[model samples]
Target: MEILKLTEKNIQDEHICCAISDKKCADGYQKKKDWLKTEFKNGYNFQKVDVRGKVFIEYVPIESSWLPLVGKNFMVINCFWVSGQFKGHGNGKKLLQQCIKDSKEKGMDGIVAISSDKKRPFMTDPKFLKYQGFEIVDEAPPFFKLWGIKTNPKAEFPKIMESAKSGTCPDKKGITAYYSNTCPFTDYYTNQVLREYAEKKNIPLTINHISSKADGQKMPIPWIINSVFYKGELVSLEMKVERHLDKLI
Candidate 1:
């Protein structure tokens, strides 16, 4: 499969791989594109398969990354996904190789990714990373794991921030969520769908948007795409709706 990089010049016409034809996420999709436009200048890279599906990888320099990781000269993978019929093909490996090639060319020490002990939504598969020669360098509460593959073995391994180790947000009230346009579903779900659900259910909701690298680095959870907390406990990281909220409330 041909891999295409989404540069600022071509991003306006390229589909971001996720939410390709989903009407509910149209506004969120544009928001994510806008977010990518700004981050592209900060060394962010988004690469995807030529086909129209969720087969893509996004990475950036660790220093310029929105992830809450501490490292030097490493490339942080913000998102890596191969969904639906795109699986079983070598698309994921190809996308990862592109990231590796880019990192090497840029003289990055290594590549790091945020995954979990097992497969979960919005988190990379640790098994896949391990298969690709990545090692679990650090781990946080509730299964958040940091995986790294260092081209320069002597370089420092990346670590999750101390703040994100808690695995819970500060808000211990009804419902608190931290989100960003990193994923196309976050903006609409957090601001519109969930907000209305919370209001109708009379549940308090607080939405925190990570609009900058500084804010992202200080987030309570390592998964910044979208995190919902209820009464100080993590509820879910995926974009949720009324049924999900019903069980929570």
Candidate 2:
């Protein structure tokens, strides 16, 4: 049950293999590594895999090109995978919960997802995110575009954060989180801001690791998964999470 961070040192280990069983994929670790390095430079954060034993969730994150809603603070879940042997046992739900918790605790504005025709089977299976209270926010034929299904923070972030920074904003905290199939720090502003509030609220962080940038209407940016935690708790501070945005920019 370890969602360890993927670094150059650990990418070639058994954990990655456990994440993806495809022999071809395991051999492509070098290409993956090279991609991660380049993606990190482009605001794309990714990890090797979401592994719990032989099972794992492989995916990536995408930057919001939609503005405010998909602002620089948010991400779109493009790819998702559960090991063939680990399907249908609540692992997917746990994986999904991890993403929700991460977004809440990390104080990320939100997570977005576009279901691919390939994964449409599972993504549209209704039971995927519905039981968790996730709703279909948008759908554009052929595929469904779901946003804010888990934690939609609202549209008041701008006005709210502007006034909150001066009133004892919040302190950042040390978190046990998930990122890039590997663990990443506060390099991205969204992560940094969210992590800061975890200290204030105290929670645990579990993020979705975005694994690739090969976007073909399925995989988006190299991103972390969906959730984060702080002090082992889940808290939604979206509107208030950006208290320091102005000064930081």
Q: Which candidate has the highest TM-score of all? A: 1
Determine which window of 10 residues in candidate 2 has minimal summed lDDT.
Answer: 160-169
TM-score of each: 0.96, 0.47
Q: Write the per-residue lDDT of candidate 2 for residues 111-189, one digit (tens) a residue.
A: 6554422343323334555555645554332233444453455632211112211211122343433333232221242
lDDT of 1 by residue, 1-249 (tens): 789999999999989989988899999999999999999999999999999889999999998988889878999999999999999878888999999999999998999999998999888888899999999999998879899999897999989989989988788988898998889999888999889878888989999998888899898878789988888888888886566556867
Q: Model 2 segments beyond 4 Å from truth?
A: 14-29, 40-54, 58-72, 116-126, 150-152, 156-249
Global Cα lDDT for candidate 1: 0.89
Locate the minimum summed-lDDT window of 10 residues in model 1.
240-249
Best by lDDT: 1
lDDT of 1 at 86: 91
